[model samples]
Target: MDTLKRDVLSQRVQQVRPSGIRKFFDIINTMPNVISLGVGEPDFVTPEHIRQAGIESIQQGRTRYTSNSGILELREEIAALFQRLYGLTYDPLSQVLVTVGVSEGVDLAMRTIIDPGDEVIAPDPGYVAYEADIIFAGGVPVPVPTYAKYDFAVRAAEIEAAITPRTKMILLGNPNNPTGAVIPREELAAIAKLAIEHDLIVVSDEVYSQLVYGTEHVSIAAMPQMQERTIILDGFSKAYAMTGWRVGYVLAPEHILSAMLKVHQYAIMCAGTAAQEAALQALRHGDADVKRMHDDYARRGRMFVDGLNRIGLACSEPRGAFYAFPYVGNTGMSDEEFAEKLLFEEEVALVPGSSFGNAGKNYVRATYCTAYDKLEEALIRIERFVKKHA
Candidate 1:
């Protein structure tokens, strides 16, 4: 009887699938000589100056827990960075709360604002985490599927149609993950208009803002009307190549932030002291290195997307972010089939579109985060694989 006892996991836990992107890598790990285009982290190291800042903080005995809301100096620095880069002002003391990473900020923002059974308008073929977290918090994920023809723009009419009386918030990713689709300003303005008319909160995830290709990043907070209702999630991870630093923040309305702080206090007392200090240093003095990294991603984007199209895959040229999301339908194979067959036959790893959402079922996501030579090799193998299948 004791041996037959049931598990203790919650219903919400059971409903979520383990990361779809991770499932491929788990198998890829056992395959030797595999040239992975599936890698998510940047190929570059955290720039030396940012790394040194973390070291200096520890050497100076700045290892103690920061105030539950984080240090004032760091908050001030983040506020200035926001203004300098995207022209948004977040009251450093009252409206900003440092979380473990952009992910945590996403969690707290949703947790604080959403009621159970609320509708969360998130992009389809979007980040797995968005849907997973929304479900974990008991809000229904309403996927807003964008398309290749429109450069995957988020149409306001589609957004307006998706909203229900129970729709509490819209989870927006500027320069989206997986798809690398950036929402244009006009589309954003339309969404903002809907948000205003319909009274919806906006959770704008701008983690990839600095990684834009030929355009500047526009924050939802930049629209003064949207600012009051927008919860901006950003961090030093991608911009500073500080993925492991676990330092990120949220800018929200004062009342909403006060509520989010309660969750942060109980769940994560504060972000790492050293990482916070390092982040502050990066924001204040690390623009040149940051710009250099962004420039490389832009160059790599062009190279990878061109390579994909030349090889017969219809890739929407990513305007931002390091990912090149291309449709794999030319091989007449499902996204998962294409990913798996390529891995087993050619030893190249890429994520299937279906892993993100149904809208991505016919696509695959390739990261330009690898070396140029490695990307070249993956494309070569992919060309062979496509020819064989065709």
Candidate 2:
């Protein structure tokens, strides 16, 4: 028989790189007593009331598929959340679509707005999935470099420089990942101006909006005349400590939302029934839980960033989210080399900054979402490693 040639995966799938975060996670799985500061998940459990809602739903046989958009009550609560937090309004029936998670919302938004060859301008060193999501949807992701000197805030001028005639969207992760740099209100207004001038959509990922310390999270959509041009992706995963529950939502203009809904209906049908029920409870009664977790994260962030600086890693205090992206260049090693050597020698696991994007080259991301005691120990180990190397 002649030799057979089998090419099974699509070109897009072949082109996409596996998650850099997952690489360290895989290695940690094989090691004993590794202290992981890589994943961006909360150490807190889902609040008791939220868990009970899901349990009660299942107990009552409410486990069937929900409305294609999601359970109506959940959608209503989501709408109300935006109104309460940012004074943005949307009709739940026409403008809200619950998704599997913010991850799915990103995929759906890209698919809904991007035609082939369209361009999206996003911050470099952003969440790892942004580029891949655009690529999977056949759009080009144009990265605008953000620097640690400015605390990694994506400037409006930089974004305007990257925009072209083909640019269709501006993607933002406020209270950004890796760096945890929250864009200031004036900066967000400036970016909103550019979006309006370019007539481009803005996909604002505000998953960490409620977790900021010493600053308010300004939603770009809430800027004057910008809501119509913005798509908001947020959910219970971060604030409510409901990561495993896997429920999120999108708020967009009705027409754009309709298109996203069509794609979602085919791809997912609807979010999990019980999860939606749980999310409803989260929206309704999880304020106290969010505040408690946010306080914990705020304290941990201050202590961890202080530790990083004391250990000569040169990290700024993160204003939001749970990550501390510290410059490891002082240790005379590339980010990858630093991460690898630290993990092997000290059993402390963190993702290399280069994994996020080229802009993160000499940095490494260490999350403070683990227990405070564990973070303290990780800092001790890291300080020991840095002294030896630096």
Candidate 3:
């Protein structure tokens, strides 16, 4: 049978663990009538106009194949979006490459730059995809832990301490997954300086850029010296609820952009023609929609975090992104046990803290991306669950 394994997978593939988040979800999915708060994706449908645009593209037979870097108009729209929102300038022609999704963007960037034994530093309770992609890229991942006391902000010294001759890059998923903590401007400046002094590439995964509650997001590329070395990974998934569409882009220096484009050109030639067009529509006609979604997320974040706190499971107020990571110590269970019990007993499924990393061991990452009523109900269920266990 072809199932017989061939050659060993470059050593790196074997080193990676399955996504802890998805692993739990697969188990939870089989449970009867379970409501999942584990995944971080928004519950909102892609805006009507964006969906209309995609449908219109299909109707017009605009699906043949766009350029490898995406349609120029879409790339231009993404570049303009950078300027409009982050005050950072990117050239649509040479600096921006639309990717399959931020997932692919992460893969492309890492695969493009990493050589065997190279090191990439990232947040401990970080984006799971980032760590996985680093391993697949043949880079060793060095995780710097972010703590609850500082709202999980990436400390500059922690980053500085992780450096070595093999350290080639630092991945920052600010408004970070699992913890929703955003890097302030001063901290961003320090990070930029550290990257410059260390001569390291900065891969800023700002996919959650638009989901911020009230704080402003400062793009690392917005810094003068850092712009040339910073690669920004962002997309319509988190911003415009276009996760299923698989549309994301990377902004890098012309050299790295060219390299990543070659990778994208060969592996996954172009992003979805319809998805790209729809994302363009989101950028052009969806400012109001974006604002509305952010407002809704902010309200839900407040509701969910406050609810968790009241139940004696305190969570930081999420400054960005749609997740609330609350410590589950009160449940008198290990993170996995807490999550499993919560699912069976309370009918709510959340990613266990340890799924993200050791630093996240005692916590649970719950998303407010679910609808308000669902979140409210989940909170009520969680309260009862906590009382029962307590």
What order do you get sorting by lDDT, best first? 2, 3, 1
Where model 3 places Cα greater than 4 Å from the true spot, the runs are 1-10
Clashing pairs in 2: none
Question: What lDDT score belongs to each candidate, Candidate 1 first?
Answer: 0.87, 0.93, 0.89
**lDDT tens digits by residue: candidate 2, 288-355:** 88999999998888899998998888997688999999998878899999999999999999999989
User: Residue 78 CA error for candidate 2 (Å)?
Assistant: 0.9
Q: TM-score of each candidate? A: 0.97, 0.98, 0.97
Tens-digit per-residue lDDT, 304-386, candidate 3: 89889999997876789988889987677988889888887778999888888889998999988988999999989999998
Comparing 1 with 2 on TM-score, the higher-scoring candidate is: 2
Span of 10 residues, lowest total lDDT, candidate 1: 1-10
Once superposed on the true structure, which residue ranges of model 1 sit more than 4 Å away at CA? none
| Evaluation by TM-score, superior candidate among 1 and 3 | 1
Clash count for candidate 3 is 0
Residue 106, candidate 1: C-alpha displacement in angstroms: 1.0
lDDT score for residue 287 of model 1: 91
Model 2 whole-model lDDT (C-alpha atoms): 0.93
Global Cα RMSD, each model:
1.3, 1.1, 1.6
